[model samples]
Target: MATTSDPNQKTPLEIREIQELAIAISAKNINPTMLSQEFLKQTGIVPNEWELGKQPVLGPNLSQVTFQNGVSIVAQPRNITFMESIGTKNPSELNIPNIARQYVDKLSNAEYQGLSISPKSLIPFPGSENGARNYITRTLLSPGPWQDYGKAPVQAGLNLLYQLDRCQFSLSINEAKIQMPDQSSIPALLFAGNFNYNVGSNSPQEILEQLKKGIDDWSSDLKDFQEIVNQRFLAQQQESLFPGA
Candidate 1:
């Protein structure tokens, strides 16, 4: 399928039956550094100072921003699953019509709630960059609405699993016990806005940051992780290859 270059396209080709939830609120009293420190403390990892200078401070004027994400959960077709399994030594079969409908219904409800808010009326992030800096620092959506922090949309799938209530959609993850239910479910997070959400040009530092954030998930499958990194950097490489294209 040909991907649409039009930014205004209602739905992108890769996304199917996507349901989004957007929440805009004042980001006051939310220090991303403090949050990061807390997260590091909890994770038992030392916070690395990259000499990134000061992460931009959000003043009162631009403090109000949307905290939003979209989800696309669909039942894998038999043929698609088979195609996906072609080279595998052991391919597992799927139980169709299992929880697909239930998830879809939940996404529909999320979309309904998301649409109630008017993003246009709210103030946009000031400056050239359309995405908010604080959100990127905190990684509200791990694996990304921001890829600079080293999280892929796929890893974000795991992150979303934790956010969602199991009662609505049966899913769980336990690292200590090494337990993960619903292996078939693939999840991603997307940002919706009138303006672009890209954070300037890709830099080595940002890429390094992204690598650090994704290192844990990277170990299981380096090939898959490399693909995501390649996709993230492709646009920049293209722009450099054909400047002023």
Candidate 2:
């Protein structure tokens, strides 16, 4: 994923290119002491260790330009390991070639990280509601971007697109809330790391574990209360979507 200089944009980027950037900024790598030292060296602000919330940032930057068709983008990742399968859905059906699998993993992880943070994975499982919530908050939400959703449109700077069918996604900005027809369709965002870094050398599993530890420590009692409210809201949403289950 090499980058080319474009004179028009503030950054060197292409107009319609889809790129994924993954980095391992784990807790062990970026602790309060390290972050404070770096911030002090750069900005001289001596940032309060608590202000950062000590979250572990993982995965790649999922940045993309407009789709080929002008109004839509289809997300059919080739290879990924889901927590649970979506019925009989198969990754091969997505039609992404073997050479493109690296892209698939990068993009999928990005989507997973984004969705897990805001409100995607907040819903409780049928039998183990608390267990499900805690797992997500600890494993995924804790180390991932739990607080990214509110600032997604701005900080992430990716337009919200609706998933009309399967991997099909369409751009819709008429309303404040973005909709998705398929849960797997991930929107785009800026890549936060250097693209020239070695691609085949990333230790994915170890990096993920490191991130999880960071988030687990950074989380607080307030996050748990928010999860409760989110759970209730999700339950209500389910009831509205399906009257009787």
Candidate 3:
């Protein structure tokens, strides 16, 4: 299975998905600083000093800038579960997600409903191996080495779990040889993504066998999630292309 290098290929990969997936695979172990740093890195953030209550926070510039690698890194706001930003950020880091429940009622006609966000959408998932390898490396950078101002290890764990919960474990067009749905045949899609959405974490032989038994359900979910993501991203693209009153 040859991976397509064309960025304009029918099935576009998303960095957010990669970030979410990496978070999922390394749920048990993560270094909050490195976790935050890598996440911030993916967001293309350059560090800065931020005043937080009595102390100051070192933040990065979360702007939509392309790196040497031609990746678009930006910050997206979201309704935070139990987190808050350090307030002052560079001009680039200003576009934080609106992670508040109360703001939901005041949203305009086009805003995403339910929750607010304040996210840093940085690099595309560095790919499965790199993404996984990143987590493995970061977990070793524990907070015990640094005392009072140590990064929140538990926070990283929770964030990792959150990402994992939202991530799909299958590899991208590269490693796992997943075919893009709209680009390939149904048989190809099914054959490639046989047990992707189904089965527990096991050997390939086990997953392939499980697919024989549980393919119907797995296929349905795979299609469903794919469609939902495609439509949502499509809608987002349309909105980005043309703005309305």
Better of 1 and 2 by TM-score: 2
Task: Report residue 11 deviation for candidate 1 (angstroms).
Answer: 18
Give one digit per residue, the lDDT tens place, for model 3 in 144-236. Answer: 533335564222211111122423433122112223445541101111111122233655455434323332232233444344334632233
Which predicted model would earn the best TM-score?
3
Error of 2 at 127 (Å): 23
Model 3 segments more than 4 A misplaced:
1-3, 6-210, 231-234, 239-245
The TM-score of candidate 1 is 0.16
- Tens digits of per-residue lDDT for model 1, 6-52: 12223222222121111111111322233222332243322233122
lDDT of every model, 2 decimals: 0.22, 0.25, 0.26
Ranking by TM-score: 3, 2, 1
The TM-scores, one per candidate, come to 0.16, 0.18, 0.19
Clashes of each: 2, 3, 20
TM-score of candidate 3 against the unseen true structure = 0.19
